[model samples]
Target: MLIHGLLAGSLALSGTPATTAQAKIDCAEVKCLALTFDDGPGKSTAKLLRILKKERAKATFFLTGKYVDQRPALAKRTLAEGHAIGNHTYSHFSLTPRLDDEIFDDIKAGQQAIKKATGLTATMFRPPFGHTDERVLRIADELDLAEVKWTGTTHDWALKDKKKIKAKVLSLAKRDGIILMHDTVPQTVQAMPEVIRELKKRGYHLVTVPQLYSGKLRSGVSYP
Candidate 1:
């Protein structure tokens, strides 16, 4: 998927407490960015979570159903630690090319898998490969999910180089920006510590997608 045309804007923080033990920050008054990971609660994810915990940074994970089934414990731990979760569809298929029923079934299955594993329904959805349209949005709305698109992406799965992935993420950082990366990418996981450090050094609060929007996300609306 291409990363382009990122618009600058601010969003409100949800009533949920900030991931850290410190005072909650209002995105409207402070610089905030939401870091989102898509695909896999894979083997590398446990390490990623430890890094985030150490850094006191929070993120949002969009889980694919197949992987969630394979790593249910990790999914539960992810939620237990205060990061937000979202559905990335059951099989990670590009949604626009699929029939309406096919699209609905996949997304619904994703919801079920996440619920079965974590016991909490996801309030967010992101279409695989960033392939989404009116129909996908409609179905997501029906499923009570707000569609989330990234403001920028590291494309770390393709880059594979930790240094390059870190550079891409730094270049994309901005107020209220939502950055896309993948926990399944080992190199990306390796790069996250320095990425989190630099973002904090630059005075940005790392937040979940819901926290970035102040927890008032509208169903079917595509977000920043």
Candidate 2:
């Protein structure tokens, strides 16, 4: 909760444009990890927020348009808590096998939905189902959003056991790694504390997606 305390002691930020509201993360010389949750702003998201706060960790949420529409306040809170937001498309549709124009529209819709819900723009995009090709990269490049991929996945969406989720994530935790997870899963939410504590014990400075990239993310680059 150190970052949360730091956030309170620092300047007050409101739900404003991203340029004015984004927090500057300082993680120089630290082993940074980017915890990214996809298909979220869901029923279990608030609990995830509490866990992140308890861990004093910053994470990134790749939200779908409809989920943001369902829980706008959660989306806003995610940004307000000094976390980053990214587009996961409007319908969580797989993009690689889809039409290029359709993929573009979905990404745009998700971006607009995020801005509407959080008063911040998504500077990153995670392809739904982690399916991407040259066309997906092109669309992301055109939108000026960095394409973020993960180095490890907890498989929390398919796995129902919290212990397994914790084990998978902890086993794969590494420096400068982006972890793919989901906020919609309750077990994953439950597994967070242990995973965070162990990672912290090992000296990882959990950070947001942009913080992991130090704001120098290359366009169309798939960060791990």
Candidate 3:
């Protein structure tokens, strides 16, 4: 999951509004959050998927179309394994200095690739470097995609300490919440075992992004 060029990615989209709390959600009475791993269905992704399966937790994977181009089987496996795929754009460049034309094309390519790889179309997108503008949001909305803004983030891509990352994760995670972590970082992957264990100990039930949106819990966006 070497992002190659986008290493400077995870600053949480410049100028984003203060995060909305997913903590207060009713959770459809299921009481778990939607865990998301972005920037990949990369080399590390299969291992991550195995870990999640062991925990009986499903998550959303926002993968870049270019990466999927090379890892077609992994992309298909992501869906087959019961996780969700979200658009993370094709040839994922920084979304800053966002141009409407490129943004639209990026999203479309991602959609096409996901459909081709997984036989499903996604209605969610995570902007590269979290640096999206109105043009990006507008296209996503126009295309009926929901712009998901996560409330809890692990900052794991920064190689933060595993214990500290887990603490941040536990402190912020909530029912029907969207928890952001990355498969691109080794440290993040290391911290996941503990994070899953803790959440389950606390009685949380992990579910995929689609399930998060479709269940009795009141999600921010409408379901298919």
Local error of candidate 1 at 219, Å?
A: 0.6
Candidate 1 global Cα RMSD: 6.8
Candidate 2 lDDT tens digits, 1-224:
21233333433233221112224545465567778898988899999999877656767889999899999999889878777788898999889888889988989999899989977767788998789888899889888788888998888888889999999998888878889999999999999988888887787777777766666777777766
lDDT of 3 by residue, 1-224 (tens): 11111211212221211111222223465576778888887778888878866655557789889888888899888777666678888878876575778778888898888888877777677877677666667778766676665867777777468788788889888766788888867667777888887887777766556556553222124322
Lowest lDDT 10-residue stretch of candidate 2: 12-21
Clashes of each: 3, 0, 2
Best by lDDT: 1
For each candidate in turn, give its C-alpha RMSD to the true structure in angstroms.
Answer: 6.8, 5.9, 10.4
Better of 2 and 3 by TM-score: 2
* Candidate 3 regions with alpha-carbon error over 4 angstroms: 1-26, 215-224
Which pairs of residues clash in candidate 2, taking residues 3 or more apart in a chain or in different chains?
none
Most accurate candidate by TM-score: 1
